[model samples]
Each structure stands twice: as C-alpha cells, then as structure tokens.
Target: MLDNPQLTQTVEQLTAVIRLTVPVSEISHVMGPAIAEIMAAIANQGVDIIGPCFSYHYKRPSEIFDFEVGFPISRAITSIGRVKNSNLPVVKVARTIYHGGYDGLAKAWGEFCAWIETKSLNPQESLWECYLVGPESGPDASKWQTELNRPLND
Candidate 1:
C-alpha cells in the first residue's frame, strides 16, 4: 500500500534517456535494453549517476505508453547512441512512495489519482517514478520502494 500523497518540490535533474512509445505489456522488454545501453553509455562517457533509474511518462497508459527510462546524472553530458540528454524541470509535485514490486504499481497509481481527484488538483500529463530500490537491491519484491511524482498545475 502507498502512503498519503504530499506536495513537494524536486530539484531540476540532468538525465540520459531513451524515449519510446510502447504498449504497456512490452514496457519491460523495451526498458531492459534501453536502460542497459544508457547506463553503459554514461559509464563510457565517465559520467557519474547520482540516483536510481526513473521512468518519465508523457501520456497516460492506453494501448501504448509514451515514456523515457533513464538515470539522473551529476552533471550534463553529451548524448550517445540512443541515449539522449534531457532535463526534468524543478517543480511542485504530488508525491507518494510505493513499497512493493512492480506488479503493484498500477494499483498505487490508481490510488494516487483518486487522491488527486479528491483534492481537486490539476495534474500535468507528465509524471515520473524513481526506483529507490529494486532488483539491484535484492530479489525480495516486498522490500522494493519506488517514489511516484506527478507535477501539479500552479
């Protein structure tokens, strides 16, 4: 289950990502290679990653999801291969943490959306999820944690 949502400000982030429009079912398949490539490219460029990976969704899920899978960098770097450089705007957001496996993310998102509706908040189309702990941390899905952030209109 997710905790109650809270409004917070996030720092602007410099990231390296591979953008794609993929069906929800194929997100894992697409993201896996993209993440590997981006991470490897960043390493090759001698760039340091400052945070866990994230997925920035540009549109709500339907038959397809328009998103970018990437990592935050310590400094801006040149793009390499399919890995392009981008920035996440520093803005006010509704935040919530999901403590579970990826399978439970949809439920968490639904609950967060309901909370937003109840508060009469205007959410932007874009949202991002930071993977605080995941496979790299361990095989225990129950121990994973992800932070979801939805930008709110001023």
Candidate 2:
C-alpha cells in the first residue's frame, strides 16, 4: 500500500547510472546485473554512496522500459563502461512511500496515478522509484519500503 502522496520539490542530485532500454519482461533480469554494475563502478572510484539505489524511468513502462539504474553519489565520476555521470532533475513531484515487496509496484503506481488524476495534476512523462529497503534488509517482504516520485508539470 502507498502512503498519502504529497506535493514536494526535489533538488537535483548527482548520481552514477547505467541507462538501458529493454523489453518489459526483461526488467527483472536486467535490474540485478545493472545494479551490480553500478555499485561496482561506484566502488572503483571510491565514491561515497549517499543514498539508496533508484530507477529513473524515462516514460511509463509499456512494451519497453527505458531507464537508469543507479545510486545517488557524493560526487561525480568519470564514465566507465556503461556507468556514467547523471543527475536526477529538480522538479515538483507527487511523492509517496510503498511498503511491500517489489512485485506490488505496478499496482502501487496505478493507485498513485489514480490519486494524481483525482487532483487534476499534470504529470510528466517520467517517474522514479527509490529503493529504501529490500532483499538486503531481510527476508520479510512486508517490511520493504520504496519511495515513489512522479514529476509534475504544474
């Protein structure tokens, strides 16, 4: 379930990311390796990971998922392989937290968008998910938390 969403402003954040455009079915397959690659690259540069990992999607997912998987970093790093310097843009967004397993994300997003529509908010083409706690935390899926942000044009 998602917490009540609120409007807020986000500061631009520096990040290290690997961009990918793959079939929707391939998201689960690609996510793990992409996250691993990002973490490895960040470690190679001795950069401090300042925040939890996140996926910045360029558009709502359909047949294709085009997005960046990475972590917020203290400073920028030179590009290495697929890992590159990127920034989470500053924008106004309607944000909420979802507490559950990753498998419930699609449903969570549907609910979130429905709320946005009820408020007559104009959302951008993009959105993002910040993974606060997941598999690494424990075996309990009920305790997992993900922060969901949908950029708004208003």
Candidate 3:
C-alpha cells in the first residue's frame, strides 16, 4: 500500500527483536486477534490486505521455532520480558503488495526473492509488518491488508 524507497536505508542493521511466528492456518485463528488489539491502538484501525507475507529473517532465534499460539501480547511480553513486534533499527527494504489469502504468502516471498535476484540486492538483516486493520472492523480476509516487505542490505 506504501511505496517510498527513501524510508528504507541502504545499510543493514544488526539488532534483536521479539517476533511472533505462526503457520498460515493459524493466522486468522491466532495472530488475527493479537493484531487486532495492536491495530486498534494505531491510526486508521483497519486491516489492510497489505498482501501475502513471509519472513526471511526472524526477530530472534527463540521466535524462529515458536508456536506460542493463544498467547496474548501482554502474556508473551510478560513471559519473554519484551515486545515481539515493535520496530527496531533495520536496513531499508523494497516493499510491495502480493494480493491474496494467507496461503498466497509463499508467492509474495517469491516476489521478494525475485526482487533480490533481479535487482542484485541483499537482505539488510531486518523486516517489518504493518497491520492496516483492527477489531473495530472485524475479521474479513478480503479486507485484510498486510504489507510484505524485504529490507535490502548494501
């Protein structure tokens, strides 16, 4: 939904973050609620289809192999003693939209793969998720907007 190359940096950053990962099947069942809470707190408060998404780098090793479903953000923060989805210093990324359901995220990642290869770009060591919806709007996959991004490292 956004296209601003200057927003991403040319250099990669090395930082630690608290990331929550889930399978495609669990997105609506799990992350849906969690994201709703966060989205409600943000402006617009609407779930934007931001598009098919996949992670090339995790916020941390712990998050990489985690199945912390049904865990509220507060509980996860309390248990881990940190926030999982906050922004940290990261390398700039070339962002895009891969319109489709959660299952199509793989194809979105493929687009990033293509960008990296075709543009001769390297990962900057950081990525991000921007939710354009929240509980106010309710769960409607068609209205779900997710921004699939790839940080390019120089």
Candidate 4:
C-alpha cells in the first residue's frame, strides 16, 4: 500500500543546527562512512534533537540545491558551527515522503529527481539533505517514514 506521497516545493527557514560532515563527490562510496561516523559518535554521545541536516550543490550562484540527503540528528551536532558562522543562505528545496529503510535511499533519491524532471522542475547544482523522519522511531525500514528533499525549479 505504500507508494510515493505527494511532494511540495516551498521556502523554508530552518533553525540553527550543528553537524560534522565531509564532502565526497562519490555519494555511494561515502554514504557508508558518513553514516558510520555519525553512528559511532551517537553511540558515544547519545542522540539529541539536533534537527534536519542537508548537503547541497547549485547550478547557479544563488542558494539552491539539486539533491540532498536527510538525516535526523541523533547526536549533538557541534561540528557544523563553523559552516553556520559563514551566514550562508540555504538552497531552495522540494520535499516528499517515503516508506522504507535507508538502504533504498539512493533509489528514492533517483525517483525524486525523476519526478522533478516530469514536473518541469530544474535541479540546481547544489545538493541538499532533509530529515523527514527517522528509522530509530520504527523497528524496520518498511515502517520507517523518510522525507526526501531536492532543490529545484528555482
């Protein structure tokens, strides 16, 4: 019964957040390491309500993203302070909800981007991430609710 939920593109003013991240052009190879580092840190520090975090790229100089990975902050994100201090504008984003585990996240991302194309949306060069929901709240990916966001039609 689970299928793609309707998506919406809107402007958002997110609250301040802290995170530690490394940029790797190869998303697939790097995703495992990123999750591992965050999980390891969570194991030691305990998860906190750090809010949603995203990585972005843009087609233009304006603040916008083409794709994003959403992760609910489970630990204190003190590492992102340096970035926020830069006073940068966040990429404009489009959001959709999905039901499944993170293993299929890449596929979900592909679908989202495809949807963007069909809907006449233009992807920015900037990538973005969103924390629609967390698997921690559910036992399995089938029961997980994830929110995927992409920067488009800006």
TM-score for each predicted model, relative to the true structure: 0.96, 0.98, 0.49, 0.52
- Give one digit per residue, the lDDT tens place, for model 2 in 55-138: 999999889999999999999998999999999999999999999999999999999999999999999999999999998999
lDDT of 1 at 123: 93
CA lDDT of every candidate: 0.90, 0.95, 0.42, 0.49
Per-residue C-alpha lDDT of model 4 across residues 84-135, encoded as one tens digit per residue: 2111145556667767776776677778777777878776655444545555
- TM-score top scorer: 2
Candidate 4 vs. true structure, TM-score: 0.52
Tens-place lDDT per residue, model 1, 1-154, is 7977899988899998899998888987888899999989999889999999999999766688998889999877787778899878898999999999999999899999889989999999899999999988999999999999999999
What are the per-residue Cα lDDT tens digits for candidate 3 across 1-154? 2222333443332221234565545545655554444434322322232222223335321314342212112211222233233323445667765444455555555666566677767765455544344323565555555565566665
Candidate 1: clashing pairs of residues: none
Per-model tally of clashing residue pairs: 0, 0, 18, 20
